[model samples]
Target: MSLTHSVNMNWKLLIGVLAGLLIIGMFSGSSGQQSSSAGQQSQSRALEASNSVEWKKVDFLELELPANIQELRDQVKITSGKAKFFDQEIFYQTGAVPAGVSRSGRTVLLLHGAAFTSQTWIDKVPTLRTLAALGHGVIAIDLPGYGKSSQASVPDNGEFLARLIQSLAGKQPIVVSPSMSGSFIIPMLANPQYRDLISGWVPVAPVSTGLVASFSSQLLTPTLIVVGENDRSLGNRSKEDLKGLPNATLPQVLPGAGHPAYLDQPEMWHKLLHNFIIKVNQANSAQFMEA
Candidate 1:
């Protein structure tokens, strides 16, 4: 390798090491300090996720990715601090649709996968927003330190999300969690405490490879498991997670897509969501009418 290239790689590696140290140190604070000092943490976090412009600070776009996917992903260099949902106050616009636009028919809780912030839905938002205009609420949330809410270290991710869901949903919400977030949803629903708070669940390409047991008969209630053809084991695992519940729907696998279809194919994701919302609302209305 050229001397210049080697030097660049070194700088990026150094930045990544520093970021790792800070992440560990910040989370290692005493309980009080962690809580108090956390409220005052700076919004900027520059973790070097890839080997680009090594001498510079860590940017969001430099992560390890395939060239095609990299070309598809266009995010900002700056990473902002977003709070965990239930940890603090996060205000959603009236009508529970989304941050932008109006006139949505149903509330959609968009739960993102791990290692990604809520902004991963940026490309998917436009398509979702269209449905919002036609009457479907879509919300993409950041898990603790992921997006532009408030920042906190993610220790108990499941509990954190449970609390976060309570705060964000306020009332019962129709949740749609993709990949790892899908696993979070299962635990959230199985808990009687949260089961009542969730109107329905939609797991997209879940990452519950080892959590198949959670899908026992009691957990199903208007659940939809979506997957992609290219997703190898997640589909089967997702099936297992919601196993005994007849109320849970089978996997709605997308064509020509992989594990991350929500981001990889926003249009397809939107269509699937649109159809699901309509069906859910329709069924809910019928039950009410019958009553």
Candidate 2:
């Protein structure tokens, strides 16, 4: 084989070895015996191998959320470090934010998008924790089969989601979702039990477009639609889909951004979400909650 071919083969083999070690370390830690130092070392080696890989795309479209054990406990109800909602398996990695104690006490229910696991937040631990510390009561959940919430059910998207919200949402919650999750979110906004319980909605890169059926036809809750520049073509057409709802607002476009702006562009997302929550709280604080 050519020298270059030999080098490539060697690199692939190294990566595979490192990956296997990481997985082994991960499972060993599952017994609550993996030392923090070992986990950090493994993570560092993993990032090094990943960075050495060839460039595939600079404009990645996925947004990653947080993936830490402490965060998991703070936001989720885990058993065997897993949660099953519906028929799908999910790895329940939770966030650090407690349910907020603001007089308004607004809770944020985070929903994952298509084909993504909560592993998205594997690199976003700091930012997520910061938001949690800010008293946002952010509950970022990995849908069924995603994150540590794996080994669960994957029932009908909308109904299963409603149950998840009811179980997780401690009070009047503000749903922050993306892509196809909006189908489930919009319906929850109209369900009587949840309708009176929903305070605000912030949909990022939602797939609520298309002529498909939806509960958008039923909601009257106030919302903020956050869109990334050069986002999905369907999301690009969201203006048409979100049109004419009484409490619906226009999209807040993120510059130099595309889909998954919340995770892909953490600083911007953090700022926008923080400000948006503060605004919603001011407008509907405990004295005048309309929901």
Candidate 3:
């Protein structure tokens, strides 16, 4: 063959190789783009699911009207009810539901300190009415021997609380307890089965039981610890005890308050409870979506 003919043949072979390379590159680029688009779509769906189904807004107007603090205090309709626990009759005071509002799945159990009755919640601060206005079912109970309830010497307060929680709320409900009531709640936290029954916990200046340090590392329940700035002994101890809770919020110190800070700073107390409940609900929704 002549030299020019051989050179032309070589050139043709080089062009063919280049063309194959270009086609491969184009296909790979297209595949990459498609994969990236699919990833973006998946992320968008996750976000939408998290946001769309998360927290729900309450229809305040449809519920009973506690327009002002005074009306909330005076308008509280008290009812007597009995629960049979271990063959013992336990009496409790439950706030009456309004004409149109549904009570199902909206209850918030309030446990007061040893010093006060369930009425302390209604009389001192407008917490019940405020929560009611926000569309929560409020049940402030007087532990046996307090308020209008019958007296009983309970062997295990924790077991009693667990039973109460199951009977009062169809599902897990937000529990708000202050001072001595913390002792009742601490045992539940230590028990895995009982702890899961509670959705969230708000403990205010709870008396320390020395058990918090043992279970704090294992606690999974969402908690908000509120303490009075002035009640150094109990408040500081509570904060230290909660240090091991992985999902717990930093201690919230109420300003210009003492042991019973909720009464001293009613507005701040109400705001904290409202926001914490919303946060817990949102987290629950996100977990449900992931599942």
Leading candidate by lDDT: 3
Error at 99, model 2, angstroms? 14
Candidate numbers sorted by lDDT from highest down: 3, 2, 1
lDDT of 1 by residue, 57-175 (tens): 21212222223322222221212233334445332222223333334346666667776555555544543344444445555676554454445555566676677666655455678
Angstrom error of the Cα, residue 256, model 1: value is 1.3
Assess each prediction's global lDDT (C-alpha) against the native. Answer: 0.54, 0.57, 0.71
1-291 in candidate 2: lDDT tens per residue?
899999999999999999999999889877564453554454333233323322122112233333442453355322224444664554444444445423236667777677565555435423345455456555667775455555555656667767666777666577877876766765555443445456667777677545323555445555666788778675576645665444555566777776776655675676666666665565454324322
Q: Residue-wise lDDT of candidate 3 within 160-198, one digit each (tens)?
A: 888988997547788888888887788876775576666
Q: Could you tell me how far off, in angstroms, the CA of residue 239 lies in candidate 2 after the best superposition?
A: 3.2
The TM-score of predicted model 2 comes to 0.61
Worst 10 residues of 3 by lDDT: 54-63
lDDT of 2: 0.57
Model 2, residue 58: C-alpha shift (Å):
33
TM-score of each: 0.60, 0.61, 0.71
